[model samples]
Target chain A: MSVRLAITALAIGLALVFPFIAPNDYYLSVMALVYVNALAALGLNLTAGYTGQLNLAHGGFVAIGAYTVGLLTVDYGTPFWIAFALSGVVAAGLGFFVGLLSLRLKGHYFAIFTLCVGSVITLLIEKWDSLTHGVVGVIGIPAPPGLGPIRFDTSIGQYYLVLAFLLLGLFVMRRIVDSLVGRTFVAIRNSEDLAEALGIDLMRNKILAFVISTFYAGVSGALYAGYVRFLGPDIAGVSRTFDLLSASVLGGLGTLTGPVVGTIIVAWLTQYLQFLQDYRMVVFGPLLILALILFPRGIVGSLELWAARRKAMAEPRAPQAAPLAGASENA
Target chain B: MVIFFQQVLNGLTVGSVYALVALGLTLVYGILHVPNFSHGALYMIGAYAAFFAVNSLGANYWLAMLAAAAVAAIMGVVSERLVFARLKDAPPMHDMIAAIALLLFFEAAVQAYWGAEFHRLAPPFPQIVRAFSLTAPAQRLLIIAAAFGLMLALHLFLNRTWIGSTIIATAQNRQGAALVGIDPAFVSTLTFAISGAIAGVAAVLFAPINLISPTMGDLVITKAFVIIILGGMGSVGGAILGGLIIGFAESFGAFYISTDYKDIIAFALLILILSLRPQGLFPQGAR
Candidate 1:
């Protein structure tokens, strides 16, 4: 097998074994939450980083995903397994609509338009007061039944479930990134005008990216709903969108680590900084400024640079041209 | 009829505040070509500065207002020097994200210092201004007057002042401005400082009608964004017009439509305009 394949399999292998090695329920919970966030971030990174689209409606899609699972399972008593899959499709549908609808608008228009979607969703959630528990939030949702009596509701069980979702998310993301579609996405990100000139259909690619990205978000939301068994209005908030955007950018947009690194760091930072409460945003202002100044490409992108440096030293005699970096794609 | 007029007047008060905030937002956008998301936070900072200045220093309201603007303007200068200056040549959107990050940091920092519990006026402004049968809150009228006065001053500055005209020249053509002996960096610093100061002044004007809080920036900024879009971005006239239209829509919509749905009106208007007239009511000379 190729070195890349070997690394990939090892990573997957670690995912399967890692839950069993957890230290405690808290750690497991944190890990599970991080994985779910990572999943969502990964999907968002595809659009924001690769397709060069900034989607502020991610949280809304996540809300749709979580709520879809909530309604389907609670109202109809559909099993978690089935509802989970359906929730993704539901989220993807909305994502697809956003992608196709806003495809023509560029930059601020797209961002603002998606923002409208999130705001409208929040409005609907508030207005529809009957279905959702409104501002009070929803509760009493049951845990998914065990895999043959495993009762994944336990801390360890959550780890496994989150692990499963993470694996699936990673696999799907990997496929999306490695496939021809991924190249097309990067091509579009690099230059839509150029890509279109090259005969690539812009609308179709954008719509597909939107759908796939939101599907992951929905799945993440569904998993979160299942875990927490409670949903609130804040799920669809502008701050929620900000959280997702920050995470995507934090881990190095367009790099694989964009999601994983961003999710873990933001989750940990937010959780630990909860005591800071209202003042948290103030500190974040300087940190974000610092992050851009220090590492414009983010943690993962910077890490890749370090690795490349190591590789350069290890192979001094090989006449080398540096591989293409993503700055050209940024504009 | 009084109640109807009251709400409309109330909205106008709020809309006037929005116009100031929108001016700050667009001035930066116009000159630097960077969407400064942190402008809203500057408004919040301005409020807090005034809040502290009044309570701790026992200053006059006007003095407090000037202090708040000065403090926020200083913060803007520091930010321009350290953060935005580095990003002057980066992609325009990168600067936007940086501004957003700065916005988040300030908000979180404020939250950490002061809990999320709402804060009312620190040093009270007079509540009543009886104008014949048209009874207006003294503070509300002040907000309207201050916003308009600032708008006039800003227009004059743009048209009359050497530096301000240079900044406008930069907006018209960065390359040409540089060719014609204008320093783009000086224009950027001026843009950011002016943007922050405008927002700071707006926050001082706003503190009377609205409670002061860190999260207070969010909804106000959304309205500002809407105004910027509607006003054919970068046009001061457009900002004022957009602000008034939204103020009335929100005012009348709240009365006629359900208040719950009122929030959607701006977003809906925004979407409609994008779909129908993407360039907006008064398109900038060359969008």
Candidate 2:
């Protein structure tokens, strides 16, 4: 546990030092974007990867958080810290209720319901003109105060702020995976029927995943709103959902570092391929086709498998970790 | 009272489109056993196909619809053969990821061609209906009628036709159906085509009432998912009933419960149903 804690602290310290090393605004900005996206993707990985549920509603939760900040900060002139914390709580609450639904559904049924919640949330954000300002979007979010009254108005300042959040989020997520409840989550994800029979309450554990994931998403959305200073319904659109889903898939679902690495590559590809402009996502079809064709385990899953093999060969493995143990034999 | 009646009628109109969309979802789920997230993208493609038919091909509205259905069916068969066929034996998650990719691809395709803007779309149908009150736009009426008619046709086709029955038989039990001389390959392909055709017809009917856009199908697709879930995974009648129920919910919800949260009605109901009956509203055994 101390080893994990030290490694995480080192990672966060390194992340804080990163933008200083970049020496350029463009690189710094892109790095910041990756950090924020990875944080959100990490949250998604908990639900989609650990629980074997794809909640497309992640984008919506982010939107909820972002808009909360956008509305409170921009419309009503609330400060950044208070607004950000509020957004996180709101997202978590919504997630808990959404998770309550997940208790009954398995696989695609959960995906379907989450997709519905996400879309409806978007539509409401778009149509609730009195509050959200309709499709015109919430704009003019203020920057946070920095060291000695300085503000994170610059891209680099914002970049570091995002990095701090991202690293903290990653550490928290890793801790979750290490905890007893985390074990229960993995168990339930493997087989709800079995997990439930073993006294792991279905409604409580799954909702915890939902709430945690939603909290990450909301915080990310708040970061996005503050950084870009504009928030719209399309941020909760299927395309965004697809991007996050693919990021997790491409990075290797369920791996701690997988989402961070995958998001960096995919996010960069999205921008890099933006030069191709119109046909960018059109190629995404073939890319996904290729990914599925070649690496169905995903890049991370394949890497994990390779790592396991190497570890096995090196040690002759005392006892291998059980596969899908939580949901084990219940199905 | 008239307003209430009007809301009911409107809800039914939109709900039928959802029904049609759910039918596509249910058909593929019955045969292939995966939720087709890309079905929404395909639904959008159907609208775009119709857009191309009328705008570029100079076909009449009616003919353009048929062309759209034909083209959509072709796309479905191509997808089943090209991607889904390969994914048949893969884990269900793999299939879902693949569908999401297709969704991203098709949506991007529409964005590239049409740009991200919405089109008012001059649907071929004329606007006026003879009755002043208690009347729907002719295009909406066509949607409702066509939805019911298509459903009827499907029901009859499945019951009466050899091939349709073969598909249903395969759905019941693939191994047993094969044992009875029904080729699973043929049934799967046929089911995919019919599902695509259903979506195609739905798009044409919906184009006039709603703006036709590349991203148009997603909202309806989510609702379609709810309908399919409420109706039961593979039950055709369930899809129809589920769609209609959602329609009434949305219509009345919009009027009574704030239009901003009308869609929440369907989702709230989805959670309610799942907690009560995880198998769906019209489970196979229940029916």
RMSD of each: 2.9, 3.7
TM-scores (chain A) of the candidates: 0.89, 0.89
Tens-place lDDT per residue, model 1, A187-210, is 998888899999999889988899
Task: Please provide, for model 2 over B1-287, each residue's C-alpha lDDT reduced to its tens digit, 9 standing for 90 to 100.
Answer: 67876897888898899999999889888887878888887788888888888888888888878887987888888888888888877667778888878877888888888888887658566775757466556887788899999999999999999878887888888899989888888788888889988998899888877888877877787788889888888888899999999999989888988876786788888878887887887778222
In order, the Cα lDDT scores of the candidates are 0.80, 0.81
lDDT of 1 at A119: 79
Looking at model 2 chain A, which ten-residue stretch has the lowest summed lDDT?
A322-331
True contacts kept of 2: 0.74
Q: Candidate 2's residue-wise lDDT over A98-153, tens digit each?
A: 78766467777777777777777877887789998888987778876675765588
What local lDDT does model 2 show for residue B255?
90
Candidate 2 interface RMSD (Å): 1.9
